[model samples]
Target chain A: MIRRKILFIGLLGSLFQIFLGCVPLTKTILSPGSPEDLTTCTNVFPVGPWESVHKIEAVITGGVSFSLLGVTRGDPNKRRLHSFLLTPEGFILFEGLLGEDGMTIQKAVSPFDSPAFAGGLMEDVKGLFLPPPGKPARWGRTADGTRVCLWEGPDGFETEFWEAKDQDRQILLRDDLGEVIKEVSLKGPFVNGLASYIELRASKPLPYKLKMTLLQISP
Target chain B: MEKTRMKRFLFFSIPIIISLLSAEAGSDQEWASLKEAAKNIRSVKSEFLQKRILPILTKPLRSEGRVFFQTPGSLRWEYLNPLRSVMLQKGDTIRLYHFSEGEWKPEMTQAVEVRRMVIAEISRWFQGRFDESKIFKNLYVPGPPVRILLTPKEGVDKFIRRIEIFPGTRPGVIERVEIEEPGGSRTSIEFRKTEINPNLPSEIFEKP
Candidate 1:
């Protein structure tokens, strides 16, 4: 009887371990990574007008969920931005400019202005969809099991790129303060794959989140 | 003595309980009637006071606007207060106008994916058919002011968690609409002086 009870307990322990292993974990932490180093990324073609739908959520300062439909074209040096607002029901509430140098938030559904709101957002999208302008200054491994690449730009912005073992591409951008001003992750660049889904969080107290999904990409 | 006191209390509460139950039933009936009334509305034209409350802000941003819709295909959403902007959908074309530019810019609405989605939505609204199956799961509740809560379908956009629409006791007027996003951003719009089928001009959609 003693041996039988022990075997039963061992079987139960194994079953519990199996169940725990099957449970999926949601990752909230944002890490830095590179585009070419990404294993699971869909091959993003560098060409004309592209559109995408993205699910956006943020929790650093506060929490909000919204989806954005984005359109972009032209080289990274000169890109045009346009976007539309939709309720989760797919109801079109408003249409606004995504990225224009002189955009004014004349009427926002939210209190934040367009430039301050879209500045960090557009930067994230550009990081994911557009290729890095120059080669990496340095490459190394992060303690968190991510491959990192540091890229320097003409402006005061420093971009760190990292890859997550066939999962997604992560990019961390910061200013001289070493504070992460923005972070982005792109999933799937397969043929006809989603363009690039991005999440952008600002360093300000009134930090905002922007999510972008690939709706359609024109060849 | 305790048993006698309990009997007396139960006897006194009977009438109050009956009245409360009757009031609840009446509220349910009223809500059903309102839903029935909404079914007959073919179109609506209303002037709305839209207030957008931003997080960490002292004042609610305000915009006064007018919305006109003709069933199945035509809609004109114009904002005239604080700033001037217009979105007009006529068959296949959508024109977005900004007062700052002082000119109407014709957008390639069909080719643009985002605009196509907008056009598709407006078209659906024209059909007088709410795609509840895809957009939202609705719940109706009773109160002095009726409340309709719309929870989005699963795997939808994250920007909006739920929306509350309160229709006034009177017909053809929506008292208020509250939109709650996942990030604590809320926007509310209140409508006043609403009219239905008021024979608005087609020129309202056509650029003058």
Candidate 2:
């Protein structure tokens, strides 16, 4: 009987590992391209501490939908207005503000009350707007000719910002093992200094996504 | 002693119960008549002014829009003021569009269930099924325009404080809706130039 229990336990452990293996975040050798390429790739992006209030409408594919008239003010850390309405009819889904203190969920409906989902959103927002956390680990180009700058964050987590010719910028946050955790892409032109559209995709936890559109920006 | 306590409970409860029954008798009749009248409306088209009050703001933000609703689940909510945004619900799916840069782009609106539920409730109002709705408990208020106060009956009650809907001179036509939020502030949508059962194009429900 004990032997059978051991076998079942081992099977469960292996299945869990396989589940974790499915998230795709691959790393490659730093592409040492021309000096001009590195400057162009990293220069187009904005450096923090930027503050703006954008009328954002975001939807989570099969999960959630809401429109936000929010004020996003932040500098060294991210400050976000956690408010949204389940649209068409204007049903309020959540109303709160989030900062370094984690998510202060003043109002949230069921399923959205989870802290991790909000935390993941803040992480994505920071990744898209604010410059990467630390100094660039390597400033180079990708094999596909996309200019890429990799910033080594704490705890083996790295953020990569890449901008291609005539294309909007893209950001990748990866774990130490080089597995991609979050993929964020900016669409539309940088009006003044902010992009009008942003899409975030997370591989782990669950297949989650948020598409954000900018309405207005201010000082 | 037990018998005396039982007698005391019945004596106090009877008057309270009687008053409650009398209130329901009057209220239920009003609701039943309103629902019966609403049953005749097939569609509605109206222009609305929507104002939202957020805590972060010093003043109420203003927006202007038009709303279209059809019975059995179809709607079009278009905002054309400070910015252009369109929301449409057909069957069980919801589609959103926003004008950005120079053209209209499709927005991801996959939260179909919530939107569906809300649309269902709104559509039922036009269909004259107010008393049959699972979302709210309706109370009739005496007014020159006639008013129905709705308090959400379920989890949605957490987000909504109360909804006061005023019907037009024509039976079953809703002219105004004032939705009170949890924070004491409310959003008032006033419908003007309301038309019912007009010849509407099938194309109006299409994605932008």
Candidate 3:
């Protein structure tokens, strides 16, 4: 009985260590590179203040889809953003401002007047337009020759940016469990390295996808 | 005590309700004339400017479009600038298209009902029976100003506060429509260069 108890405790100890181990993304294994490589990847995010208009096609969970006109103005350097979505006939569905004090929603119509909806929208916006939080712990190339900059948040979540040889880019966010919670693909005729088309797919408490095509952009 | 409160409320409210009814009844003559003018309209084609005002916008967002309407429920409404989209209706069938990548693509099926409602309202306006909306109480306001006010019924008021329609000097022509939301946001559409009974191609109503 004493030997059996020792074996059982040893098994539990090993399980605990495995649970606390660094979780690596199974698909992409990144090797160490340099700070210059990280800077090149960061340029994908816009710097300073800019305003943009986009035609957004959204497919919500259960396959319902709709189109909206999205107008956003943000100074990513200051972490301030104002955005609104309008129907084609000019009905405002949602309008919100994100400042130092966090998000404040000015107006939200039915189906959008929820706190969860507002938070999700802000998360997607920040994910696309702002660089990931914290310095990248790993800046390197993936096994497939894709340039990558990987940041690990204090909470153990991971953000990975990958730039393919064709100049297309992707941003993937993984939970502490190592499951991809969100993935964003950036492609199109880029101006100054800013992509004109963006596709964001979020899989979490609920799944939704937004396909945004740039209509206009200004400084 | 509650009974007395109810009694006092009715005592004050009954007279106000009567006066309001009388005021609407007085406008029946103007309503009949507007309807008469509408009967003369065979078709209408107009360029329109739409302005959306919201507290978030520094200025109203402006868009331009054109509308084509024919008798017996055939219509085409096309936005020409900022975003290019078209809504077409013929008989009971409705179609919506969006311009993307230099080509017109059909919009999703889920959003068809919402677009259908807009087309339906435009149809009612062209028929000069816009006041007959089931969701709103049409209170005709006879004016040197001349406009129709549509106030939403109980449940509908949660979405729409009111809608005001201004009739043009020409018979059966609508000068503008202003939609007010429960919030301070408003949308105004002003019609310009209106052409009445112009020869419009059938394809305009059939295709986007």
Candidate 4:
């Protein structure tokens, strides 16, 4: 009976590890480029604080699409963000403040009041406004000549930022198993280093997509 | 000496009581007159400017729009600038639309639910029945511009703190509305160039 219990516990642990994708898989590496290449890649992120309004179209996994007015005030230096969403008729759906410690939600209506939804939205705000966690682990040009800057997190996750010749940018976040979990694309006519259009897609937690169009950027 | 003091106290208190009673009576009289005026209004059209004030923002977000209403339950509320969207209601059927890529598209999502609630509230205002809300208790204040204050009851107080409505000099016209939220955020909408008893086309309330 003791042996059977031990076997059962070990099987459960292994399954949990696999579900978490804890085993780090090898990712592709490019040529080690110069310092100027790193600067060019890092410049894609905004440096100063900014307030902007966006018209957002969100599509959930099951073909549920809705529109919202998004207002955000982000300070990259402080790594703090205040964001809220409003319905067309001006009812506030969600309002949250994200700081270094965690997220504090002031208001959240149904379908948006879940903790998972709040965490996912905070992750997206960080990805879009702030730079990666630390210094770049690798900076170079891909085979197609796209500028790439890769940052590796302590959790065995990797974030790669790409800038094309036309100034279009793409960010890919990979989990420990080297599978892309979140993808973000930015197209410019940038205002103060902020993209005029942004699209983000995530597969983890749930499959969702958000397309944001710039409406107003504060001076 | 005690009798003299009592007489003096009554002399001051009686006028104060009488004035308070008259003020209350005057408020009720104004309310009844406003309701009587609403019966003559067949339609109403107006331009509106909305300002949303929040502690998180340095400046209030502004939006401009238009509102149209006809008797027997038809309303068209359209936001023209800063985000183009419209809500049309004719009787029980309500439709929502958003303008994208130079065209209006039907919005069949959860957002329509929020708009429907707003339309229901506006419909009550158009009917001069602002004091008839089951969720709020109405208090009439007779200002230079008479104001109607609605305070949310127990269950609904979590979302809304209060609502203030200012009626126009003309009957059945709402000049302004301010909705205050529990979290120190407020939305103020002011109406302008109001036209009362206009002939509204039936097609204006149709679906997008």
The reply for model 1, stretches above 4 Å from the true place, is A1-219, B1-32, B91-95, B107-133, B206-208
How far out, in Å, is residue B36 in model 3? 1.3
**Model 4 spans with C-alpha error above 4 angstroms:** A1-31, A143-145, B1-26, B97-114, B155-158
Winner on DockQ (2 vs 3): 3
Q: Write the per-residue lDDT of candidate 4 for residues B152-198, one digit (tens) a residue.
A: 54444445666777888777788998777655677889999999988
**Tens digits of lDDT, candidate 1, B57-99:** 2344466788777654677776675445566777766666544
Say which docking band candidate 4 falls in. incorrect
- CA displacement after TM-score superposition, residue B100 of candidate 1 (Å): 3.5
How many pairs of residues collide in each model?
Answer: 27, 1, 0, 0
Please give the CA lDDT of all the candidate structures.
0.50, 0.61, 0.75, 0.75
Rank by lDDT, highest first: 4, 3, 2, 1
lDDT tens digits, residue span B14-69, model 2: 11111122233236777777877877777788898876555554455567888787
Off by over 4 Å in 3: A1-52, A58-66, A73-83, A93-122, A139-148, A154-157, A162-196, A199-210, A216-219, B1-26, B100-106, B109-111, B142-144
Instruction: Tell me the tens digit of each residue's lDDT in model 2 across A164-211.
Output: 766778777778777777777788778645778777777776676666
**Clashing residue pairs, backbone N/CA/C < 3 A, model 4:** none
Best by DockQ: 4
Q: Weakest 10 consecutive residues, lDDT, candidate 4 chain B?
A: B9-18
Model 2's chain A TM-score stands at 0.65
Candidate 3 to truth, TM: 0.68
TM-score per prediction, in order, is 0.41, 0.58, 0.68, 0.81
